[model samples]
Target: MLTFEHDYTRLPEPLWLACEPSGVRAPKLIAFNEALARKLGASVVPDDETLAQWFSGNEIPSGAKPVALGYAGHQFGNFVPQLGDGRALLLGDVVDAEGKRFDVQLKGSGRTPFSRGGDGRSPLGPVLREYLVSEFMAAVGVPTTRALAAVASGERVARQMPEPGAVFTRVASSHVRVGTFQFAARHGEETTRALADYVIARHYPEAREQDDPYLALLECVTRRQAELVARWMSLGFIHGVMNTDNTSISGETIDYGPCAFMEQFDPRKVFSSIDEGGRYAFNNQPAVAQWNLARFAETLLPLMNVQGEEGVELAVEVIRGFEAHFDKTRQALRIAKLGLAEDAGDTADTLMDALETLMHQGRMDMTATFDALTHYAEGFDDIRREALLALTDQPEAFDAWLEQWRAAPLLNDATRFDAMRLANPVVIPRNHRVKEVIDSAMEDDFAPFHTLLSVVSAPFDESVEARRLAAPATDSQAVLRTFCGT
Candidate 1:
């Protein structure tokens, strides 16, 4: 029953100490996430003037503290003791009619205790990138943080260049990260145990009834993350930054900076401008999740039992299941795209090999190649297969690959068309196209953004106007490096 201005002092004790809002410069109103705001049953759209005040730091909402919740993270390969919401502040948790909880926070709001030397503001380009990318991710059935609204903070943020500024009201299951536990664990056993108990009560309430609640929490998070990363791989998503801080305990993908959907099926594809070493490449994601989970395990080790070594041993055993869980989910997705029902005796490896060869040789459009094949077989046209195969240099590879594929029973199934449509999306928010939308919107020509947003919103449909969305970029137009607007 908090009003919009109860002040930070009366919120959570962790957020009690904080500076007041120092309104940002150059504030402007950009976009409102009508869909997400409605999901929260929170309407700020009719109150446009107040949006500028709240986003630009001219006002702080009720139950919100201007505090930057603290945590530690492994940035790239190194651990930093500090990397909180440097430019953001938690506005407390919002609960829905179903009693589900969500954290509503303002990104690019302003500087905080964790601001360090950074300006603590977000640029409009990244704001659009996140809003578009995150919404598309959510619509695609991927667990992701949703954007509530975006407010242009009549300001400029510096990167290599200056740009117009904005703020996003980002909603997520919980802001708790692997780094959150790491921060507590690194501090001491008491803090680690406290965080673990809090997390169990908040996220995995069922774990509270378990004999070893902390270990149960570890297992729960590991399973959720395994399934989450598998879903990403199924769609060719490479989360450029797989830092512990970016790893959410609620299993949703957060920190969409520098993330890219694979243009081709190369397992080694690395698109993040910040990922020079390819540590978080397409194939490396599962392994990185394992690594990050190990960190989580370490945090909960002290709580596994009264004896430390016993606790560590138990956590490691549960963590080992992460790889197998990811593999099972991944293999399920792979076979589904080819209209192959899950089976034991079938060799999915050979089918995957054929797809890989096609991708490597001719840059065969990954989403389209399998999508087209799902409806085609002996009774259909081998010519369509051949024509589609022509898109790749591995026509010979596709030829060698198709012999056994034609023998695959599901290709002839009456419901193959239905299965294929469900397995393959007709569209993704293509990088180049997304960049175009952002660029056009930046110039105040929001027509392109509006159009693409409309098309990409329903990625499974075959809209005549959206034919462009199903196609790959021209060779010259391929965006090689994606950046995390961090």
Candidate 2:
């Protein structure tokens, strides 16, 4: 039996709306994450029939207190004051055998007050996309929400065309976001402080020990986001939508819609079809994160200090410090990727920038380039070198960069190869491969999806068949723009 604790629903009435998931005619289990289920302390597995009912929201589990969380967000830089969990309901918190707590939520469960004239359903494509990508993110050691289960809803939702519906069981540390704080602040300072105190108690108990608890909370979140975004950069993942609502205070990657892993190493690449202006491009993630944190800080001003002006000054100081923290995290990631034992200072920056410039100029595949370099570093392999050099427009330019990289003092360590192996993943959830999975699943063939999942589950390992999935997209397979299927 699953046990739940409704701490979020215990908050003031305005913070959320108690609701139930809309029932579906038929529920079929599409995928179940047995490992993740075990992690959440499930001792017994339900029969397939019952499992489908529970996950699809056709029947609620015992002790579940469902509530739709309320919040507002800045979508594409436009403030939408009342946007919230329109199609998701936080089922409640479950404590695992390890004594850790997690929130169980059902996305595409149905509409709530926040539905905003929308159907409040998720298409099969996005559901499979989130399930695949979230699991891939977890396997890669990135902080992110995990997919517990996926169930076909036996219903149809009209989008660009009529599509089958699906519900995803999502697990996270907490659903609270930067946008949540903004929503609380809208109610009043009292509401904002209440939310702050609750968040501290639930997520950061150490904040209570600080003289300025609110400021302490801000600093902690800033550090997590800095590290989080740097990790995304290292993996070549673009969040696509960096709106305030999508920014998780828990620092986990949330809202998988339109998110894509980069194939080529262009820092300016954007996949979200809605991101026409490239506000949330690959290189712009750090700045967008800083901007979102600034908004979070704005909501905490009242609780920040006794005087309003003092609070503003304090927040300004804290925001300024975010840059140094992010720079340090990003530099360390770059150093590891380069297999450097010590900081390379200016030489490191020059080489890394030059490699990226070459990638942009040559349209080199991001994952392949890094993996090839790692192989070349471990042992001077002519095959690997030639294959990588072939991707560049000017092989001479790459040869010159290689000379500089070899001359760097930081590469003297005997363990550099192993370090690079750990830093560079041989497989990523390539856009074309993911499209292959989605396309096959739509036709009721889940073999490709399962195979892709297995390959990405061990990203750093070598598998000959998996290498096929790592290839860059062909002309017909290239998915230039990703959509937010709302």
lDDT of 2 by residue, 235-303 (tens): 899999999999998889999899999987889999999999999999999999999999999898778
Writing each residue's lDDT as its tens digit, candidate 1 over 117-227 gives: 777788877777787778877877888998776777766678888877788778888788999877766677776677777777678999988898888898899989999
Leading candidate by TM-score: 2
- lDDT of the structure predicted as candidate 2: 0.86
Residue 90 lDDT (model 1)? 70
- TM-score per candidate: 0.92, 0.97
- Span of 10 residues, lowest total lDDT, candidate 1: 1-10
Model 1 regions lying over 4 Å from their true place: 1-21, 43-47, 344-346, 374-379
Model 1 earns a TM-score of 0.92
Clashing pairs in 2: none
> What residue runs in model 2 are displaced by over 4 Å at the alpha carbon?
410-414
lDDT of 2 at 76: 82
